[model samples]
Target: MPYKRIKWLILWTPTVTIALWEYIRHTFLLPYLSMDLGNALAPVIVLTVTVTLVYKLFHLLEQTSDSLQRERLAKAAFVEREQLARELHDGISQSLFLLSVKLDKLEHTQDKESVQATAQQIRKTVKHVYDDVRQSIASLRSEPSMTEVQWMQSVEEMAVELRLGGLQVELDWRLTDSDLTSKEKIELLAIVREAMLNVQKHARAKRLIVNAFKAENISAGGFNCTIMDDGIGVDDPALEAKGRYGVRMMRDRANAMGWQFEVGRNDSKDNNQTVGTVVAVTKGG
Candidate 1:
């Protein structure tokens, strides 16, 4: 009987201690100790509590140290990103400008072979530089500023530029001019631009919607820009498709800007006439 009791006690050791400390603290340790023992034993109690708290304090300090390190690292990364953005915009981006100018001057040349060769080289170089800057810009995700009018001008200008490059372009806007932030405007424009490029390259849509505005529930304030085409729409988004690449890229760009990126075709319930890939972005109300 004694051996059995001892074995049970060993098994219940933790539980008994928990019951004493939690349920029977007054009878366990308080009544036997003097209330005025504080004067005599305050230091010991305080020291015991403080010693236990010291571990928490150390954990807090370690967390603070980690936060400081993270902030420093993030700052360094931002600085580097800015530096790279500026250099590419200033340096290689300028190279595109030069090439454009030289190509312009060569328009009067009569040598078919030379002209073709020169044009091919120009295309190759310009594409390489553009891809580089685009990669860099995509990486940095730099936010540039513009008023509503300026924003319109920038998008239209880019559309015209693309049109001149032999890609069809269209601009249709219903979102009124208001206090849209620089970041918001840029994000929306990026969606339009990516969608346009997708239409040109993947969808093989002859016609394009370069700048389109969409709204729901409220007008002007609560609005989104959309780009729709008559090209091939990806039937399944879960599977990788040509148009989906642009859709996914646009969605990601919008997400990074805290905006909702929406992709749909016009054949559904609300709008079935919508034939091709549609890129949409929502703005503030």
Candidate 2:
């Protein structure tokens, strides 16, 4: 029962019980017991009933709340599993397809130079697939502690993986290990990973620069992360369409955390050509 109802019940139960006892004392229980005795016992009976009923009702409410919470967590876990499955399928399937093509080429070509190049490409692709699987497994198996140094290390590892895809990555870290919440850290890690994956899958960039650190001049008392890629620069309509999902997901993560996200082509000072793509996010205080 709700608190209001319980409060009202406790407030009115004594009066109602006394009224009933007065009406029934002369007719109902007087034949078996004295009127004064009946009056004394009626209040005790009412008190017992009130206490027992309130205790049982509150216990039920507590149980129900616990059950609802468990259900919610279960649902969230299911959704996360489904999303991971989709990501692995998309990423691993592409790598496997490329690997198969290279193998086929190696089998058909008799030229030593062509075979050597194909074998090298296969090794690189295999390493990338291995890294992806390892990261995915880690994400599934455990939630890492939200420590600043560890989070940065994970970003560095991701940068290493991007290097496997031939993207040169530069990391600029300046943030102090303070004031970041666990939720913020998790969301930031996810956003960074997704952004890097997008770069590897579609950016076709030769160089990527990731700057993540605290800024003293920022109004929102939070850190900043900018990922710049010197690639074809998100100009191709087909590539844009393919990358839209990742961009949307990153934006959603930032918005959900009350952060700011911006993505666009980095135009040169001459304004004559697209230089690269920049994905920038700023977390709010």
Global lDDT of model 1: 0.60
Q: For residues 1-285, could you state the per-residue lDDT of candidate 2 as single tens digits?
A: 554565566567667866776777777767889767886888787777667865665666677667778999999998787567545753575567557756766888899987897788889889979977886776654544565236666677667656644568888777655657777777787777777767776667777777888777676557889887767777546434854666766777789888989887777622233447888889764
Instruction: Give all TM-scores, in the order shown.
Output: 0.57, 0.55
Shift in Å, residue 59, candidate 2:
9.5
Residue by residue across 1-285, what tens digits does model 1's lDDT show? 243444454455445544444444356657676656534564554455445654455556566667778999999898776557454643374446546744774686688986886687678668767766775667555434464226676467556555644556767676555645566666676566556655655676656764545556644545667777777775655325653444565666677776666776655422344466676676544
* RMSD (Å) of each candidate, 1 decimal: 10.5, 6.7
Cα error of candidate 2 at position 26, Å: 14
- Global lDDT scores for all candidate models: 0.60, 0.71
Model 2: CA > 4 A from native:
1-70, 76-121, 124-141, 145-190, 203-208, 219-221, 229-245, 252-258, 264-276
Query: Top lDDT: which candidate number?
Result: 2
Among all windows of ten consecutive residues in candidate 2, which has the lowest summed lDDT? 266-275
What 10-residue stretch in candidate 1 is worst by lDDT?
Answer: 1-10
